[model samples]
Target: MNHAPASVWKNPVHFLAFGLGSGAVPKAPGTFGTLAAIPFFLLMQPLAWHWYALILVLSFVVGIYLCGKTSEDMGVHDHGGIVWDEFVGYWITMFFAPAGWLWICIGFVLFRFFDIIKPWPIGWVDKQVHGGLGIMLDDVLAGFMALACLQLLAYFF
Candidate 1:
């Protein structure tokens, strides 16, 4: 518990605070956080592409605050539980994916793969950085890698 105050446990803040406690899961909390984003994305169906993009953009903006606040509350520089950044970053990864379950699966799997592996520049960012920006930035780079690979596959196929 790390002595988190009772106030942080209230309302949607708690769920958001705890990353719904998905971050507390014994294994692969970041993957779970990104997976949670899929349902929300599904609910936003039929909106224009720009609308989806806007939602992702707004989420990134909001994630900056929520992650920092949640981390502060948790008293860890970057609590593994604070994963809104991963959600937003994964959402960005799916931006170029065509709207379909197959693409969704691909995006989900590939994003998780890159995020977990943290190859090259992504790994660099994750290891060398600090704070909320570090938490989010590495995932953002992971998303870029996933997006690049997916887009490349799309182009060839």
Candidate 2:
């Protein structure tokens, strides 16, 4: 069912940008990329908050390049199969989330909702931005929105 170009497999940058092949899925590639991010979140969960934040920042910076390069190679701006953005976005959403499956699931749903719905500034950025930063910023906004909701839920409930 994968319509992803063969370049996704042959190119290392494309492979990573494609969420380690998860983005190659024919359906809901973004969702699959976010799902692929879970194991990484689990590994990072044990780190102190500052360390996690550091990694998050680094990931975002690197993602800009990765997404940009892959998009260039593919001749498509923000291709659905290039999902490094989703991975970073999901990580942002899970930042400081409680250590439990329930919280993880909630964070995932909230992130997916915001990413998919593309409300307000998220939608605005999606339209206005271009290239790799464009590919990443919208998802970054979605992650922050989802994170806000997650934090509020954790605080009140």
Task: Mark the 10 consecutive residues where model 2 has the least summed lDDT.
Answer: 1-10
Q: After superposing candidate 2 on the true structure, give the runs of residues whose Cα lies further than 4 Å from its correct spot.
A: none
In order, what is each prediction's RMSD in angstroms?
2.9, 1.0
Best-fitting candidate, scored by TM-score:
2
Instruction: Name every residue pair that clashes in candidate 1.
Output: none
Candidate 1 CA-lDDT value: 0.73
47-124: candidate 1 lDDT, tens digit per residue: 788998889778776676777676766667766666777777777777767778887888888889998888999889
Candidate 2's residue-wise lDDT over 1-157, tens digit each? 4479898899888899999999999999999999999999999999999999999999999899999999998888888888899999999999999889999999999999999999999999999999899999999999999999999999999
lDDT value for model 2: 0.94
Each model's TM-score, in the order given? 0.83, 0.97
Candidate 1, 133: how far from true, in Å? 1.6
